[model samples]
Target: MAGTSQARDGRMALSFILEKNGAPLTGTSGSLAIGEMGFIISKASSTSAFGDIPVGCFFIASASTTLKDGDSIQKVKPYFLGFATSKSLSQSKNVVDVTMDYDAATNNVSDGVVSSSGSISGSAITETLNMESGINILQSRFTSIISIDGSTIEYKEAQTTEKDILMLGWNFRDCKVGEFLDIDIVPALFSNLSKDASYGSSQTFNVDYTGNFSDENNFVGGHYIVKNVEGLLPSIARPQAAS
Candidate 1:
C-alpha cells in the first residue's frame, strides 16, 4: 500500500484527488476558496461513461491571493477550477490542482497584503500594523494556519467588535518565543462578497501582537477579536525591522 500526502501553501502548490464516484453528487455543487480573493468550484456535469471524468466536470482555478486556517475572508469562483475527464480514475486521481497567495491592501504606504499562507512548509505570511497613525480596520488578514491541516476561516467571536479582529488572529496556538508558528486567513467565505459592511459603515479592527521569541514569557493568545478599530484598513504590511 502507498501512503498519500497532501499539503499546500501560499507560495506553493497543493494537489489532491477528491473522488465521489468520479463525479459530483446529484443536485449538489462543489467549490473552494483560497484567501480573500481566490475561489473556484467544480463545473456542473452529470455525465458518466462508467470510467471517465469529463473535463467539463472540472477546471483549474487561479487564486488572486492566498489562504490559511481561521481566515475571515476567502476568494472563490462562481464555479469551476479546470476541466478534467478522468472519470475512470485509478482509485483516485488528482482532481484538483491549486495555488494560492495572500492578498494585500492597495496603494497604502504603511500597509501591505498577505498573499496566502499555510502552517505546512516552514513558512508563514505576516502583516504589521502602524499604530502610529491610529488604526481603523475591517477584514485584513483573517486566515490562521493552525497546523499542517492547512488554513481555516476565523469568524467574529461572540459579541466581539469588528475593530478587534486583528487581535483575534492570534487567539489560537500562542506558541512561545523562539517557537516558530504560521498564521493565515480563513481561505473560504461563501463565494461572492469577501465580506459585508457592518451597520452601514466600514468597520475597524486593531491587530497588535507580541511574541517573546527569546524565551517563554506570556502569550496572550486565543481568538483575538477585531473590534471597532479606527484608521486601519483590511491589509497587513511586511516591513523591515529597524536597525
Candidate 2:
C-alpha cells in the first residue's frame, strides 16, 4: 500500500462505522460541502477510512443531501467520504487525498435548497444539519462480562489518563442497552468523533444513525437519563438497535 493510501483509508474507514440497523455498517462518509460554487456530496476514496485530521476534526456524512431538498445524491463511491475542515475549499491548491467515484454526469441534484445568490465575496455561511430522535441517560452502571470470546486485549500498559477509562477492547463494557456514550470524554455530551462534516461541494452534512433501536423508550439497568431528549444527529444511536 502507498504511504498516503494507508493514512487516508485509516482515517475515513472509521468515519463510516455507523450502526446501521443495529449492525456496524463498515462504510465511509465521503464528504459534503457548500461554498460560493454550489452544493456537493462526498464520494468515498477507499474502504480505508483513514484521514489525517485533528483530534476532534469531523465533517458531515450523508448518503443523501439534507439542506438541499431536491438535490439528488451523487454516488461517488457508495461510501460517505470527505476531507477535514482544516482549510478552505480550493479547486487547485488545497484539494488533497480526495477520491472520486462519480462524475459530473453521474452526480445528481434535486429539490435543492433554493435558487438564491449572495453578494458577499468569500463570506460563506454554512447551513444547519438536522438529526433524528434520541435521548441521554445520566446515572447508570455499565457492567459487562464480555467473554472477550476468548480474545486478548492489545493495550494494557499504555498510559491512560483518569479522564478516560483505560481499558483495552472493553470500552463497550461500560456501555449497555440504553446508555448514550458521549464521544467526547467530557461526560455527558456528544462523542469526540465528528458529528457534522463538510465535503465535495461545500454542502453541509451530518453523521446520523438512521438505524432503529431494539425497543422504543426501553430503559435498561445501565441507562439513566443524562439530559433531556434532544434531536441531534446520528452518533447518538440507540445501541439497542445493534442488539
Q: Who wins the TM-score comparison?
A: 2
Predict model 1's lDDT versus the native. Answer: 0.21
Please, what are the lDDT tens digits per residue for candidate 2 over residues 1-243?
222222232221111111112211223323233210111222124322222211122222322323222122222111111222221111112223333575444443344322211110111222111212111010001111221223542222222111111001111222333333222111111112222235754533221111111112111011112211232223312232311
Residue-level lDDT tens digits of model 1 in 1-243:
111132322322121111112222222232322222221222233332111322222211222222222111112122111111111101112233233354343322322322221121111122223221111111222432222223543332222222111111221122232322232222211111132236765432222222211111111112112221222111222112210
Model 2 CA lDDT for position 211: 18
What would the TM-scores of all predictions be? 0.14, 0.16
RMSD of 1: 24.4
What's every prediction's RMSD, in angstroms?
Answer: 24.4, 23.5
